[model samples]
Every structure is written in structure tokens, then in C-alpha cells.
Target: MAQYKTPGVYVVEKNAFPNSVVEVATAVPAFIGYTEFSDNKGTSLAQKAWRITSMAEFNAYYGGPPQSKFSINPLPAADPKAPPVTGDFSITDSATKQRTEYELKAEGTSYILYYSMLLFFMNGGGPCYIVSVGHYGDDLDADKISAGIDTLLKEQEPTMVLVPDAVRLSAQDCTTVQTNALMHCGFKMRNRIALLDVYDGYKDRQDPAGDCVGAFREAVGTNFLDFGTAYYPWVNTSIVKEKDIDFTVITNLDVLTDLLKKELSPITDAANPTPAAKVKIDQLNAALAAITSDWTKSQDPATDKQTLNKTLLAVSSLYPQIILAIQKKLNLLPPAAGMAGLYTMVDNTRGVWKAPANISMNGVVSPTVAISNDEQEDLNVTTQGKSINAIRSFIGEGVLVWGARTLDGNSLDWRYVSVRRTMIMIEESLKQACKAYVFEPNTANTWVTIKSMARNFLTSVWKRGGLAGASPDDAFSVFVGLGETMTADDILEGLLKVSILVAVSRPAEFIEITFQQQMQKS
Candidate 1:
């Protein structure tokens, strides 16, 4: 016989041996509010300690019963070519009559989405995952549910699933542990399926307390032992009956198999193709040819000759098609201009040319010695005199500076000879002329002065050419000084400096010049 010492539920097992005693305490202590027991072993224990809780009373106070009475019609057979059904599910509170409809599908259904949803309802569906797949919504509820569904589908073997909806999970009234467990299981099975009700607790509230409380209530209602409403689909009695449930059992495994095959076959074939490597090889060859063609024409001598003399003309005629190809390739000619007027200048006469190294008063290097500084000063005095006379004859009152060391054994360098010659000319021509400053060590100030003098000389020469000379528009030009061969870093720094100067000075005339007098011929 079992005797009760306190007001609580306890278990007493009868041992086969008459004198043996077996007592098992309740898994949990009796609730101060309500106490329940599984079996009536003792009359006093049933009447005094335990009470029978009615499922109706539980439903009236809490939400309506879960879908225990209802059964899920097995998923409909998939029609590969058939247009998908577009309807979604609508949930309504029996007491409040408030209903919310979620759009189900815009895109066609997948096996994972169908199977997961069917399984949830079949396995005593409590709360389900619903996703509003058709249209986008501003509410976060839909997004959360969609994510839950995706997570479920990715699982290796998911036991539970989530539905997609605009409602957020935090808004749903459900227990964290229960909801989380369902989500985890769903993720394990197939993540694409989602439940709509999960986001109901998150409503307008910002905190999780309401959601958590709701989840707890949901969990309590969903307890396996508790007699509560169970999840069931809205079935059509005309097409199926509860006892004849097997009729709706979709046995057309071909649909899923075919879909899986179609989806996976392309991926496998794409991974290893018989002719893919050959196609890639052909594409690579085509690209190489294009690159080579561009490179060859860029430096073609016959296409870009400095002079259009008879020899050059003959060469051009021989490669007329090549020249045309280069012109088209480079895009150097504007649409209206064409190539007829493009003439290269050639000087056939060997006149009294100044040494190439001779730096003229107008800051231009004489064509003869302009090729090198050393060769300029090495010119005989007769040649030097004739060069200066030619400049004076052509343009009055200009400076002629010897710019290189003469090959003669004389120790005099061209720079000194050029400066002295200029000073003499200035003294004879203009009484007030004077050498502003000479660059002995090539400081920043000396470089600035040199630049200013060169600019002034070029301006004078251009003015002397009257209107026929190149116009001094506001075109930006770059000039590299012959002080040293510029490395990439040096060039970059120089460009930066020029940009700064242009921005700050806002000069009317901008030009870039390179003095390669000191550079090797190459």
C-alpha cells in the first residue's frame, strides 16, 4: 500500500516479492499551482494529490487546439512540365477571427520544399515553417522565414523545418528551445521549407521577452502528453478521406528523380567536357593573334616614316594595305580628315647647318649638332662661324651657344664656348643684354631660370614665324629635361610636380619638353 506524506505526485511500483518496496519520485516536483499524475495506483493519491486537466479548458484559455484531429494529404505529384500551383496558406485565429495570408510560390516547387512541408504535417505538426516566395516584402518576417527554410534544405538529414514569411522569428509567440530545436531539425532535413507562425510572436515589440513567452506557451501546448490542437492541412473531403490517407500518398518517385537528374546532370557534364579544352585553346590563340597584330603595327617603320620622300612613297606603295591597316588599327585619323594631307617633311639639301649640339638663342637645338652635345663643340671654327652667320642672317640678334666638347685636342668644352659666343653677340647687338645666371651646379633655382629662358626663347622664335607657327593654345604638354634618363619613379614624381604647378600657377601656356642631349643615341 502507498501512503502520501506531502501534497505531491509520486510513483509506487508493486514488487513480485510480498515484502519488497519500490518508490519512484516524480521527475519534477508537484507544481504549487496544479499537480498531475499519469496512472491511478492509489485512490487517495488520485483524489487528494493529482487532478485531471481537460483539453477543452486548456484550448479556451490559450490559443485554439493544434492540428491533432486533422491529417495531412500527402504532397501532390509533381508535373515536370505542368505549371506550378500558385496558392499559399492562410492562418486564422478561431477566437479572434484574425487571418493572415502568406504568398506561397512564384517560382516552381523543388522536392526538398515539398517533402519537408509534408513531413512536418505528417509527424504531428505543431508549428510549421512557411515562406512567402512570390513577391518581396518590406517586413523582416518574410526574410527570416526564408532564411530558416534555406538552412533546413542544406542539412544532410533534417528532422524539422522552418517556413518563410515576412514576419520575424522574434515576433512569434513560441518557446526558444522548442522553436530552436524545430529549426535545427528542419535545417538538418531540408532548409528550404519554412513555417509562418514562428514570426507571430515578434509582432510590433522590439524585445524577445514576448516572443520567448509565446514560444513557451506553444511548447507547453505542443507537449506530446498534453492533449492540444495538432497541425493538419486544410484537406478536400471530396477528393480524399481520413482513413483512406494512403490514396494521397504520392508514389511518383519519377518526378523527384527526374528533377534531381536534370539539375545534377548539367553540372557533371560541365565539370568534364570532351571538347572544352580544345575550345579554350582556340580562344587563347585568337587572343594571342590580336595582341601580336597590335604590337607589330605600333612600331612599324614603313607605316610611320619621318619623311614622305620618293623612297618612303615607294615603300608606302609597296605596303599600302599595311599602312591602311595600321591607320585603322591606331585610330590616329579623325573621321572627316582622312590620310591624304598627312605629309612627312624631308630636307634633302645639306645647307650650312649648325652643329646638332649647338643650343640656339631661341632655345632650339641646331639640326646638325642637335644629335649630340660632344659633336656640336667639335665642329671647326669655320663651321661654327657659318652656323652663327646663318642664324643671324635668317633671324636678327639671337644667341648661339657652343654646347659640347670639340673632338679637337683643345681642353675647351662647348658649354663655355657657347656662353662666350652668346655674350659676345649680345654685347655687339644689344647694349643692355646680360647673362642672368649660369647653372654651375644645377640647383632648383638654376633649373627654374633655365626653364624661363627656354620659354622666352621659344616664344620669340614662334613670334618670328608669324601666324604660320603652331598656335599657343592652352594645351597641356610635358617636357622632360636631359639632366638624366628618367626612371618610372622619377617620371611619376615629375608628373606630380607638373600637376601641382599647373594647378597652382594656372599658366596660360603649358608644355612638356625633354632635353635628351646627354642621353645615349638609343
Candidate 2:
């Protein structure tokens, strides 16, 4: 028996070169030894010992060799690029003109294409198919079919590639499958038809050289079809549709742009080269010179005198206008009357005033003694002596009589009411005056309290009939009482007290009575 060189069984002929044969025997299956078989299998036979020619002859004779007990690490699975599958299909028979709809189920390798198809659909790709063929008994047949499909793909340069579905065994069963696979590969397939010729042309001794041409043309036509209705406005683009707004009210774009540029120019210019502050010292100096010259010329005795008189008359005539201007500038004015009058008097006096004299009599005179200027005037019967007597009578009678009358006509009533009212007025006015003085000097309510007290006191006395039908002595006493209450060491206070006393006393003789006597001795 002759052993085979390869590790497969083979048949051997016992004949020599001419034809001398004895018995026909099968060759022993040789083992091809490697690292995996080194331990159990002995050293390999020499290459010179075998004369194996073909794998076919070897397998034909010794194909039932003992299987090697060795471990094999299976190869990593290939990431096959399977196309997509269709879920359902509607088929129309051209001859019968009948339509049938069927739901397609995916299996085996077809499921992979279906999954890819689903992913494509999710990613905005269109639908496609799986073109499958029936079961091939061996890998050789599968290789042949795969090679034929690869050749067709390369020659036609189709947008999509198709492969057999492992579960579907017939081309008719997988028609929609092929359509779906193409769609999932981003190929649009509609309006045009695809015909798949599945006959094994090579095995059957027929040529398939031009078979895919029509199918390729159909695919190209489908791909380039003008299905204008399929193009939707909202799909495949990100442009935002906007509604119209009335823009007439807004400034023009060019105008706004120009304005913006103008505005920004200042800032940019400022950022680069800063501008210096403008100096007006020279102008101010010129103005000052003119003002000083005018003022000096106006101050001349002859010129100033006339100018002063003119200015004073002008001011008097336009006093309201001047006051309005002043108020606009200063927002206030001094009180016009009342306390202002009292303050003006105090200001004029410069803190001092003459007081009225108090009159008193020793005793009343008897009835008339006549005076004669012609007769050598007796000292007792002269006009001067009678005048003195009359004066004494007036003081004596007036004080007692008017004082009694005032007492009778509720004198204490006015006194109490006046005192209380005056006190309240003084308190309120003092607070107001103090606040006004603090906030606004010109508007200060100066001497308000003192003025109020003096006015109230005099009014009270006058109302009590002390000023009416009263003797000088009675008037003097009333004035003295008012002066005593209103008197203060302060200039304003002194002026207020004096003003009221002058009004109250109605003095015939202006006597400079001492204010120290009138003031409270403390």
C-alpha cells in the first residue's frame, strides 16, 4: 500500500508503470503535524515518502481518516455588511393583473439586514430590501454566489449591495427583501422595477455577463426619479420659517447702521487718543477785565450816584420780576411781614432801643387854678404850674380809674388766654424758626416767637380796654408789663419788645427809659 503525503485518505493502484498490477488498496490518511499535535503525534514522515497529487483523489480514497483530537480557537466573526430587509410587501402579477399583500418575516442573516434597515429608517434613510437565494449545501456554493454578487456590484457600481438571506431559500420568497435592503442603504427604489436573475449561469453553462445591465439601469432610473411629491418642506432642511412683522415703524437698517457707527466712533476715538479738557481761563480773564472796567467806571462818584439812583428805581419798579428770578434761583424768600418786620427793626436798631418811661403821681390836685401870662405870673398861679398839676391829675386819675375798669372787665381773662395762646404760638414758631434757620438761612423764621409774644401781649392789653380812654400812666403801665414779659437780652428779643411797647404806650414823650429795669432781674 502507498501512503498519501497529505493527511487525507486516498486510493492506491498496485500496478507498475506498464500495467503490471496485483491488488488495489487505499492509502493511509497522513497527519500534517504542527505545534498542536507535537505531544501525542510522533515526528512527521519525510516529504520523499509520499506522492500525493490532488486533494480530490486523496479525499476520494482516504476521506474517512481518523479525526485528530485537537483544540481549535474559532476565528473572530466577520462584521458582515448586510443590507436591510422589508417588513411587508405588495406584489402585483403582470399577467393576471392581480395584487397580493403579504407581511414579511425576517430570519437568520436576513434579521441583521432588517436591523440595519431599521437603523437607517431611524436615521432618516428610506426603506429597502433583502435579495436572498435558497440554501446552498456547501461553502463553495456560497462563495460562488458571493463572488458573482460582488462582480455584479463592482461592474454595475450600484448604489446598494444585496446578499442572500440565510433563511429564505428561494428568489421568489425574498423579492421584497432585496428591495428593502437597497432602501436601507440610502438607495431610493420606486416607480422603476428591478429584476433579479437567479439562475446559476456558470454551472448551467450560460453566460451572465450582461444580466445585471437592465437591473442597474432600473436602479439608476429609480434613484434619479423626479418624485416631486415626496419632497416635503419641513423635512431634510433646518431653515426656520418666520411670520411677517411690520418693520415700517423701525428705522432702516442702513440708517441704524450709520447711527451705530457714529455712536461708536466717539468711543473708539476716546479709547485711542483721549481729548483734553477745554480751558476757558483766557476767556474768563477777558470777561473779568470787562466786568472790572465797567464796575470801576460805574463806581465813579458822579457816575455811581446817578447809576445807583437809576438802579434803585429800576429795582423798585421791577421788584416782582427780580424777586421771581431770585426765587427761581434760591427756591425761597424771607418772610414778608410780621416776624420779618420785627427782624428788620432789630437789624436796624443793631440790638438796642429806647424804653418808655413809667409815670407815677404823689397826690391829686384840687380844682382849677387859672394861669395868666399878662399879670406878673405868681409861681403858684402860672401856666407851667397848672400844667404840672393837670399832668399829675391825669396820671393819678387815669391809673386808678382805668386800672379799675380793666380789672372789672375780666382783665385776668385776657391775661390768661393771651399767655396760654402766646406760649403755644411761641413754642410752635420757635420750633419752626429753628428748623427753617437750619435748612434755609434766607427763609429763617427769625424773631417769630418774640414777635408773636409781643403782639399777643399788646393785643390782649388793647382788647382789655387798657389802650382806650386811658391816661398816659395807665398806658405806661400796660406797655411796661408787655415789655417785661417779652424782653430778652438778645437783639431780636429786645427789638420785638420795644416795637410792641411803642405801639402800646402811644407815648407823648419818647423817653429813653432803661431796658435793664424792664427785663427780669436774674
Candidate 3:
């Protein structure tokens, strides 16, 4: 109210509607891993939570993908009495009739944050946060990844945490990082969930050494199971293309050179060669020798790599095969990033209450390890109650996310991922909307206003099929009066309290059809 000493005609306006609750974002995920670089102009985003909306922004700040290094080595000769030795790839020289078995070993650079980002965006991911713990070639440390998870504590928009590079670490260390992430999401913040990738997820569940899922269950402790979800059998993807990699990825050029020389000897050692043929062969050999020499002499061989790579590709037919092998290795990535993107897609297209399963993943060829129906039964339900989601590929359908349970499979309340996420969304929205009424009067009027605001927000959610009920009253309840939620002493101590209950919708995970034989219908 304002007093007017010399006012001609005072005009006042009264607000008719109460303040509305704006829903907080529910799909933004925070990814923690290594990158090529983390810089914005002159600023460094290393170990910082940087928000990016598109792949372009990520590239501008974090730079492009890191260059991976691989080495092709000849397999050792096998003795006649001993078992035969095998290699990842094999090529036989027709000229010398020498069978050479070679294995491709990725050296130095194996960071996957770049490819994970590509997978996320390809699967409908939107705005996200990137926390670069270190650069490429740096050793993967559990402590560093834990520190990256800690940085998200100050941020409120990230509703999920994903450490895609954790799988590159040892199984024990990866478990340590995942445990920290779950603790941060469930116990500390209580606003997000952790998307975890099982270490050795590329291996089959029934591997001779041990079951990957069982090992994950034993190592990942039982704390905060509801706040985390794990996916098994990493998916094979086409995110890495032929142009993305070249001969430069090979660390040892000597093996490649020897193989190419032996392969080209037939043409060069001909009895009667034309002038043009001889000149072409001589020039090709000189170029190949020069490329190896320059790379060996210089500390950094990437200076003239593009030119040398072009020459190598034109000279040798083996170059494309090696590049393809590298591409295949890079394409086998963990499933956490793809799941995060699917969560975002589900939340955006259908409300957050919808389960993020039975949906095909973009840019995915198939799951590395195919899981049968019987195998998935053990994964979906266990005596220990550690549930792992599965990604399966069908003949007609490309690849789909199959299961939707959290790590705590037996909990009736928090078993489903959609239910847990919807609760978080509702809780966070109301918490933020109530901040405006913090210091207001603690009376019937204030109570009514707060209750109306919450009911309106929940009514909107219920209408969107987020809550399961016949009507608004049946869907949710909000109470804030003195007798209902607070006592006289609580009011006297300047404390205001409110209680809310919502019947969040649950997914029909299993549907059974009953059949009966009918007789004599005329």
C-alpha cells in the first residue's frame, strides 16, 4: 500500500492469478571424461562443468576428436608340435607364398568422449554439460573422474551423470568411479541418476573367466541402487567413418611397409617391364621409403601426414583394410551415452513418466554380444536384486533398448526408471516454486496460495499422463495448513512445511496373453 499526499487519481492493479510453477528440465546429462582440448577462446574448461547445446559448441570448446594410435604386429611363428598361433587379422603375400598373421593393437589414445558425444547427439540429445577431467593420452584415474563428478554438485540442470571413459580403466577403478557417481546423484544431490556402464561390457555374460554382470554386481556396492542404472553388452555402431581414420593411426610403420613391399614385389620384379611401369613402381617405392624415414626421424610425424597418407593409400591395397580395422575397434563403444540420449528423447517426446525402452537407437548397427531371452531373464531379475538393462537387435527392427529397471530391481517403489525420474521432476519443480513464499506470512491465506499453486502444477502433470489416476484428487494431494503439515511450535520457530503425494505412473513391463480352447460355437 502507498500513501498519496497530492495524488489526482490513483490507479492500482491487483494480480488475479497465483504464481505458476515452471517445470525444471529433466533430460540434461553431465558427461565426464577426457577430451582433445577444453578451451574457450583463451579460457580453460579443464575440470569444469561447461554447458553446450550442439556438437559445434562442443567442438569449439573441446576441440575435435583425438587421434588414436594403433600398431600392426606380425604374430609369432607356431611350432609344428605346439598349437597354431592366431592374430586379429591375417594377410598372405602371393609372391612369396608367406602367410603373415598380424594383430592390431591400439596404443596411447583410446579416449571415447568424442565418439560418445556423437552417439548422444545422433540419438536426440539436446543441451548437456561436459566435464573434461584431462586431455587425451593422460592416464585414466578414478580420482580424477570422481573430481569431475564433484563439479556437477554446483549445477542444478544436470539430471543424469555419465562417465563414458570409465570403461577404459581397470574393472576395480571403474567400479570406484561408478560408486562415487551413484553416491553423488542419490545421497548428495537427490535430484539426478547415474547411467553406468559395466566394465568389460563388450564381453558376453557367460564368459569363461567370469560373468561380466556378476562381477559388476560384486564390485558395485549396494548403496544407492535406485539412483543408478547399468546396461550390458556394448553396442556396435557406425559413428566412426572411413574418413575419420587413416594410416596415421598405425604406430609401427615398419610392419605395414614390409607387408606392402612383399605384396608389390610381383609387379616390380617382372622380367620385361615397360618404361612407364618401371618409373611408376620406382616412384611408389621411393615415396613409401621417404614416408617411413621422415616419420622415424621426426619427433612429431603428423606434420606431413596428410600427404604421406594419400601416397600410402594410392600405393598399397592394404591401407584401406587397416583403416577399416581401426574403425571397427573405435565403433564398439559402451551404451551409457546412447541411453542418456534416449532418456532425453523419451522425456521430450512423451513425458518423463514414459519408460525409455523398446525404442531403436540411432546410428547403431547391433549389440556386440547378442543376448537370448533366457539370458535376459537372469539380467532383468536376480536374487541379489541388481538389475541390468539389455539392448537387443531384431531382424526387422534395427536395435532397441529392451529393459527399463533400475539397479534395485526388487524395490516396488523405485524399480522403474520412469517412476524415479518423474518423482524427481515433480519434487524439484515444487521445491523451486516454493522459494517465492519462503518469508511470507504463515497463515491460512499463505497456506491456501501454496496449496493452489502445487495442485495446479500437479494437475498439469496428471493431465499429461504423468500421474496415474481417474481425477486430479486421485492423482495427487498437497497439504500445507498448520494442523496438516506444521505444528504451532514449528510456526513459532519460523518453519514452514508442506507435504505432497503423487501417484506416478508405472510402465507395463510384462504383458501376458491368456488363451483358452472354445468348443461348439454355432
Predicted model with the maximum lDDT: 3
- Compared with the true structure, model 3 gives a TM-score of 0.92
lDDT of 3 by residue, 1-522 (tens): 998899599999987777999999999999999998999899999999999999999999998888888888888888879978787767787766778778899887579999999999999999999999999878888899999999998999999999999998888889899999999999999999999998999998767878888999998899999999999889999999877776667778777877777767777788998887777687668767776775646666665566667766776677767787888899999999999999999999998999999999999988999988998999999999999999999889889999999999999999999999999999999999999999999999889898999999999999999999999999999988888899999999998889999999999999999999999879
lDDT agreement with native, every candidate: 0.25, 0.25, 0.90
lDDT (10s digit) by residue, model 2, range 418-450: 122222232333333334223222211334443
TM-score of 2: 0.12
Clashing pairs in 3: none
Query: Which of the numbered candidates is closest to the native, going by highest TM-score?
Result: 3
Give stretches of model 1 more than 4 Å off.
1-52, 60-85, 88-522
Error of 2 at 266 (Å): 99
* Clash statistics: count for each candidate: 79, 18, 0
Worst 10 residues of 2 by lDDT: 228-237
Stretches of model 2 off by over 4 angstroms after superposition: 1-386, 390-446, 468-498, 501-522
After superposing candidate 3 on the true structure, give the runs of residues whose Cα lies further than 4 Å from its correct spot.
Answer: 1-13, 77-86, 93-98, 266-287, 295-315
